[model samples]
Target: MTLSELIAQFRTLAFDKVEPYLFDDDSVIGWLNEAVKEACIRGQLLHECDDVDICQIAIKAGQVKYPTHPQLYEITHASLELTSINGGKRTPVCLVSFEEMDKADRDWRDDQDKHRLDPYFLIQHDTYVRLSRPTDEIGVLHLEVYRLPHKMSNDDDVPEIHLAHHEHLIDWALHKAFGVPDSEVFDLNKSEMAEQRFTNYFGFRPDSDLRRITRHDVPHTVKPFWV
Candidate 1:
């Protein structure tokens, strides 16, 4: 099954679990499906051939720790709890890309901020999307990263989601290996910190102008990324 289809089915089960919280079942389902689809696409294989289950393998193999999408929910929950956090001020959802880092970048890497090197822990299955507000003056954009488990052995289940397209397993290796945003870091000692951090983390560099600058204005009912 495609990611979207898989998630539609899972929504029923998830809704029952979170019925007391009044969480919007549809939105959660959409977000999860998107994560899975992205994961499969990055793997460059059909969902069935190389789905997110590889993420479980990564954990079992001691590659990384957690799924970025679900971890995002944790981040969102924390953001929501703070009265200081506002819609525009607080970072919106993060967009994850399911691509592995290049080895050339890895061999040449040399930076003091090894914490940013966390991308080595993540596989391509995990990424995130972040929304920016007018006041923040940043454009809405997706933040694709490698995700890893925080505390799990090599035998954990992979995070999965079914969208309309197919069922995809999360790339926990990429999720754990994600690069933190310059905004996320409290220090600003150098202008190259973010760039350096991404290199160390993902062993790749994104465009500097590519700062969080895209918006997910469309409804989840429509697949915007595909369009």
Candidate 2:
């Protein structure tokens, strides 16, 4: 549904269909943005692989880290791309938790091997990617990731997510509408119910589902270097 359509749905479902609506267009759109973001983050709806700015990261020699996509919700897979006669050569880079690295080798941080290429990436603070070691050469990491929603503007705007999930957006907006504090539309019971429906369809927001998706990427205790 378009922004206007979704707003109308929110009004109808929220029982503010008459004149002087309890929820304004701008307000409902704000709730929509939040809802879509939650849907994308939790359901991994807006997965991207070919978007250059989002799926590609340039690397400079000696740099061990790089800023990830601004709207990156989570990284699913990462591969290193190096200059090659065939244009570019891509190699899989393992993803691991710091604790796993610590368990395998306490001296993991001491490697500081300037001669080594980035072999792994650690998700740091949800904004920057920490490399296993400093880069020996310039390259890029091709990534597959789920991204936050694009902000919708006026009524003409549309959501980036697929049309299949459009009607579902209304549930979240209704949840927000019913939860409006100090507002005429506020209803705690309805708010909870709406939220429950949204969650039931989209599932809860993921904390770190990437780990489960890439469990094999974790280094083994006996063969830590193989990763």
- By lDDT, the best candidate is 2
Tell me the deviation in Å of residue 8 in model 1: 6.8
- Give the least accurate 10-residue stretch of model 2, judged by summed lDDT: 211-220
Question: Backbone clashes per model, in order?
Answer: 52, 0
lDDT of 1 at 28: 42
Candidate 2's C-alpha runs over 4 A off are 84-88, 116-125, 208-227
Q: Please give the TM-score that candidate 1 achieves against the real structure.
A: 0.19
Name the best candidate (by TM-score): 2
lDDT of 2 by residue, 88-109 (tens): 6787776776766677678878
lDDT tens readout by residue for model 1, 1-227: 43333334444432323445332434444344344434433332232212233212211221122334443211111111112235334333322222212232443223323223122221222243221111112222223223322321122223442232232222221122122243432233332442353234324323323322211122335546753
| TM-score of each prediction | 0.19, 0.85
lDDT of each structure? 0.29, 0.78
Candidate 2, backbone clash total: 0
lDDT of 2 at 203: 92
